[model samples]
Target: MGRETNCTEAADTLQRLREVPIEALVPVIDRSDPGRLGAWQPVIDGDFVREYGSLSVKNGDYPKLSLIIGTTSDEGASFSKLGLNTTEQIFDYPVKQILTAKIL
Candidate 1:
């Protein structure tokens, strides 16, 4: 039930963000603006995020549970793109590319 709510909210937010131009997003991101985090948020995609983090609690998936939530003053600071800036670059950016980049 709670998973559905979280998934719905994330999907709604992602849909709203997809309508905005990426060019407009670049400046706000470059400035590290805290208010422009909507685009950087996790979407309710079944691939990357198979289920909401809280779903385990509802489904009794975990035998033991320990939860911790942390906050950063500048959460957007970590969103710096290594080389992906242009549309072409973004299109070429795949899940493997991201994983490889992080590993390197």
Candidate 2:
């Protein structure tokens, strides 16, 4: 919900949020058919999160702390199932390439 911009825009957004009903602030998530739905993500304000966190590591911006990297087998399979057409198409998807680029 937090996005970076000029002061004017930020103030405007704050005003709108204040006027909007609290119920509207709740994100809608569809577990049954989750495609292009709300996601939990960090806002890149250029200070704490200057870029995609993974890209920062790949670019050698190692943090002064321990780190962890892993993913479950078939992590995106459920997502791909609902978002893609066929199994063949899923196999052809560039999931590996995208991960390699972000990690290496």
Candidate 3:
């Protein structure tokens, strides 16, 4: 599955018909490093298609077809680029909302 704030879960459930017999991944999100994104990731993405992704087979009696889905394009890059340093900076502003600080 995923950690948090990842669209993979939604995409997996919403658009799993695209790929069959293949489960989707979580785009390898950042697990450590404290930050808004870090904190947010696990809160939501921990259950996207259950990481291994979901396997759906068409047909009741006979398994004629199977559908699979994984993290979409760009989502991986977006998730990868987002590090504690980058996201933490967002909290540095006057709000000090937590996202203002980054590891960088």
Candidate of highest TM-score: 2
Off by over 4 Å in 1: 1-37, 62-69, 74-104
What is the C-alpha RMSD, rounded to one decimal, of candidate 2? 12.1
Q: lDDT score of model 1?
A: 0.58
Candidates sorted on lDDT, descending:
1, 2, 3
Better of 1 and 2 by TM-score: 2
Cα deviation in Å at residue 5, candidate 3?
19
Give TM per candidate.
Answer: 0.27, 0.32, 0.16
lDDT (CA) for every model shown?
0.58, 0.57, 0.39
The reply for model 3, stretches above 4 Å from the true place, is 1-35, 38-65, 79-104
Candidate 2 structure quality by residue, lDDT tens digits, 1-104? 43312224555777755665545444322223455442444778798788987888789886667776887765465456565655677775566656667888
lDDT by residue for model 1 (8-98), tens = 3565766655655767655655555444556566676887766766895688755574766788764434454555555576566765587
Runs in model 2 deviating more than 4 A are 1-28, 31-33, 64-74, 83-104
Order the candidates by TM-score, highest first. Answer: 2, 1, 3
As a TM-score, model 2 comes out at: 0.32
- Steric collisions counted per model: 0, 0, 26
Q: What is the lDDT of candidate 2?
A: 0.57
